[model samples]
Target chain A: MNLLLLEDADFVAADRAILRDRRLHHLQEVHRAQAGDTLRVGRLDGAMGQGELLRLDAGEAELRLTLDRPPPAKLPLTLLLALPRPKMLRRVLQTVAAMGVPRLVLLNSYRVEKSFWQTPFLEPAAIREQLVLGLEQARDTRLPEVLIEPRFKPFVEDRLPALAAGSLGLLGHPGEHPPCPRAVEGPVTLAIGPEGGWIPYEVEKLAAAGLAPVQLGERILRVETAVTALLARLF
Target chain B: MNLLLLEDADFVAADRAILRDRRLHHLQEVHRAQAGDTLRVGRLDGAMGQGELLRLDAGEAELRLTLDRPPPAKLPLTLLLALPRPKMLRRVLQTVAAMGVPRLVLLNSYRVEKSFWQTPFLEPAAIREQLVLGLEQARDTRLPEVLIEPRFKPFVEDRLPALAAGSLGLLGHPGEHPPCPRAVEGPVTLAIGPEGGWIPYEVEKLAAAGLAPVQLGERILRVETAVTALLARLF
Candidate 1:
């Protein structure tokens, strides 16, 4: 873990935190940390600073924290993605979180197999676990809000328009459309489709919802790669 | 598989080919393809075209080949990566190929774990398998050439200079260096470090080899994500 993330449960006092879970194991094995060493640390949804290790043991580690710096700024974008397969969903969650997405909508498209929705990876607790892993990887603290939309039509027609009203709504699809914009000036609402891509009717519906179609050339990238590439190109 | 890749052994005649492998199973089950159905096809390291399924059975499937179209152009870049752990190395190879990296040098770094060099994933056949999967994912034909450099100091000082001579040699390091350039016109040579990043002396040696350091903001990304992000931003 890049930053030792601290939840309220990890704290023993206002300034002292006790890590007894995986963090403790990571400190012992991966870091080979010792008492008196200072490490990067962040409080959940709070500030990031340094922690001076006061005590280290196999059972737990105690640190005196001095959280002050705010977490890194999130992207001024809301990512709407077609829910990938169970295995891919986990990685995408980590990728989205690590890339600093502030909000995400796990959407459905016609091409999304019916079985994908039944995956336990969609569970809230499971989702949170992946997001936390991402925060640890990126050394951030704030958790991105995630929304699930198993039905495509209602979410796009009823909620997306209002949610995307002030943003540069764009659809990441393969076609003869304009290339995805670079270094966009303001907020963006980007929707990416499933493996076989969005059907014609769904694209039309999304277009009516203000998300105009865009392309990233001919090579079809995997969902995770596409997410990283699109976000990198946009910002 | 987006494209049915054809090797020379698959060709039965000047205009025909046979398949009795994973591609055959994919046609039978995934595609549920029938005789006379047309599928996208590409020759290994050659042109891409459409193939008409002439016969289909559990045992074998035959196609009439008419190769003509060229594969997607590769990136005007060479990627130099500190060899990741075996699992990440496989994914990175696929990512590199899918993103159209023409060449890759899997160099060693000070922070790279010694055990990483012993992975069977580094074997030629194993590497080719991942590259083929990448080509299939991206619907490209040509394979990226991979070079292994087990010794860091000698490779950086003795050979990297000439190798990166005319390109915009850049190192993806996390520091106060200039941000990586975007949409450059010429070729590029990018070196991405291992998980914990390159040591100071290693960075110095790379600098002397003509690569200057560049940052990708404060958030640290996983090696695979960093590769995609850097490539997307540069291209």
Candidate 2:
């Protein structure tokens, strides 16, 4: 548990901030927090502080906190990824968020199988859960904005331009090309393919749209690996 | 398992191969293979083959195999990484092998916590097990060789020139002035950092030893991400 994040309303009471359900569960199970114990806590849109557990019970807990300052400014990076397998999608979202990319655009691609779109795991709440895990890992309070585009053409032709504005855009593919640039200034937009990878036509289209076809090397990486690798090198 | 991996000894008799233990468990549980099922199989140092289940039972299973052609060539690159956290290490080794980087050098780095060296997962057999998963994922039978360097300085200075022979050696770091190149030919040796990333002095020593400090981008990626990203762009 990096930081215990709470909502604005949850922090409203002056006497003691009472956490009854999820927070209490976290305290007991994840943190193994006890009475008089201090856990790293953060308020919504507020600074990070320690929460002193004044009292604890099976169901609820009361904490006395001292909020100080907010988290580090998040990097201005947008990840444009093809929707992956359901379980993998969750990992990707959480991992991306944890890495400090503020925005994620889950787009469509050619190699993406048809069944992926039908998964119930695509629900916004499920995606949120993954994002929350990401936030917890990085100790960041701000939730990254996630956008889904089931249609490939519309996303790339219409929405991607504005998002790529003032950004260094790069596409990851495995080929004998230049390595993906390091230290790109301004906002950055990175495109990664699906399991089987972006077909030649799709690569051409992306290249025509100003996304450079850059590679890390000759090895073919999984989707999750490619995304994480791009963020690591670019950020 | 993406690809069913078999060994020369696995081909017991002229026409029959008996699969028992873990492979049988996977065939039963994961693949749900029944009698008459055919699976893609690879022979160690031999060729990709087809396995036809001739009989099945709790004790062992009999398979009729048809050996054909060699597995795909491994990716034309090599990787040298700082030993990451054990949890991340499993994924790193697995993914690297899956991508077909035939060799791995797990070196020590400045940000690599001292305690990490104590992990039981660092054992050769344990590390090779993880690489097997990657090989299975890629459907390739040849296992990647793994090397360990518990000490950082001596390895980078003494053994680097020989290991890096005929191969471009690059170090992936976040802070260095310029960015890393995207793609290059011939064999390559890539050195990545741990979770906390590479300390400056460590990067300089490698750079002075004919290694190039390549940047992925402005964002700091986790060690796992950095390795994959550098491999994608550099190899």
Candidate 3:
């Protein structure tokens, strides 16, 4: 973990926290941290700063916290992803959270197998676990909001236009379309398709909803890689 | 698999190929491919074309191949990366190949765990397996050349200069350095550091060899994410 993330439940006082969970294991093993060592830390949805290890034992480690600096700014993005397969879903969640996406809409596509929606990984707790891992990896605090849309048509036809209204609406499709824009200023609403990509009809629906198609060349990248690549290029 | 990759051994004749491996299982299971089905196929380090499934059985599947199109062009870049942990190494190898990176150098760094170099994942066959998966993912037909440098100083001081000569040499570091450049028309040589980043002395050595540092803002990304982000932005 790049940053030792502390939740409210771990706090004993405003400036003191006790960690006895996996964080403690990470401290003892991965970090090989000792008492009196200082660690970079951040509170969930709060500020980031330093923590001085006060007491260390097998049961728990207490640290005096001093959270001051604000978390890093999130991307001006509202990502719409065709829910990936369960195995890929977990990694994509972590990638999205780590890359600073402010919001995510896991929408269905015609190609998205119905079984994917039944995965345990989509559970809030499971999703939050992956996001927390991402926050720890990127040293950020706030979690990105995740919205699930099982019905593609309703979400695209009813809610998408409003969500995409003021943003630079884009569809990360593969075709003879214009290249994905670079270093775009202001907000973006980007929809990325499933493995086989968006069906022609779905692309038209998204286009009608304000998201124009954009390509990233011929090579097909995995969903996680595409997410990072697109976010990096856009921001 | 987006493209059915055929090795030389898979060929029974100049135009006919038989598959009795994972590819066969994929055809039967994932693709639900049957006799008379036509699928996208690519020859190893050769051409891409359509394969007409002539026969399908539990033991084997036969395809009549007609190869024509050239694979996607590789990136005009050589990536230098500090060897990541084994699990990440596999994924990064896949990422490098999928993104069309033509060459890669897995170099030693101060922060790189010595155990990383000892991983079986570093074996040529193991590496090739991952790269092949990447090529299959992207529908590409060529594998990237991988070079390993266990010694950091000599490789950086003696060899990097010649390798970086006439190219846009850049070090993907996190600091007050200028933002990484984009859309360059020429070749590039990029060096990305390990988890904790390159130590000061290593950075200076790399600088002397021609790679100046560049930043991707404040948020720290994982090694794989950083690779994709940097490649996407630069290209």
lDDT of all predictions: 0.95, 0.77, 0.96
Q: Which lDDT tens digits does candidate 1 get at residues A1-235?
A: 8999999999989999999998999999999999999999999899999999999998999999999899999999999999999999999999999999999999999899999999999999999999999999999999999999999999999999999999999999998999999989999999999998999999999999999999999999999999999999999
TM-scores of chain A, one for each prediction? 0.99, 0.93, 0.99
Candidates in descending TM-score order: 1, 3, 2
Model 3 chain B is weakest, by summed lDDT over 10 consecutive residues, at B180-189
Cα RMSD over interface residues, candidate 1: 0.4
Residues A59-163, candidate 3, lDDT per residue (tens digit)?
999999999999999999999999999999999999999999989999999999999999999999999999999999998999999999999999999999999
lDDT tens readout by residue for model 2, B109-196:
8777789899999988898789878877766778888888989899888988787887777877766456777557777777787765
1 against 3, candidate with superior DockQ: 1
Chain B of candidate 3 vs. true chain B, TM:
0.98
* TM-score for chain B considered on its own, for each of the candidates: 0.98, 0.93, 0.98
The global Cα lDDT (0 to 1) of model 1 is 0.95
CAPRI tier for the interface of model 2: incorrect
Tell me the DockQ of each model, to 2 decimals.
0.94, 0.23, 0.90
Question: Can you write out model 2's per-residue Cα lDDT over A148-184, one digit (the tens) per residue?
Answer: 8998887787778777877777888877778887656
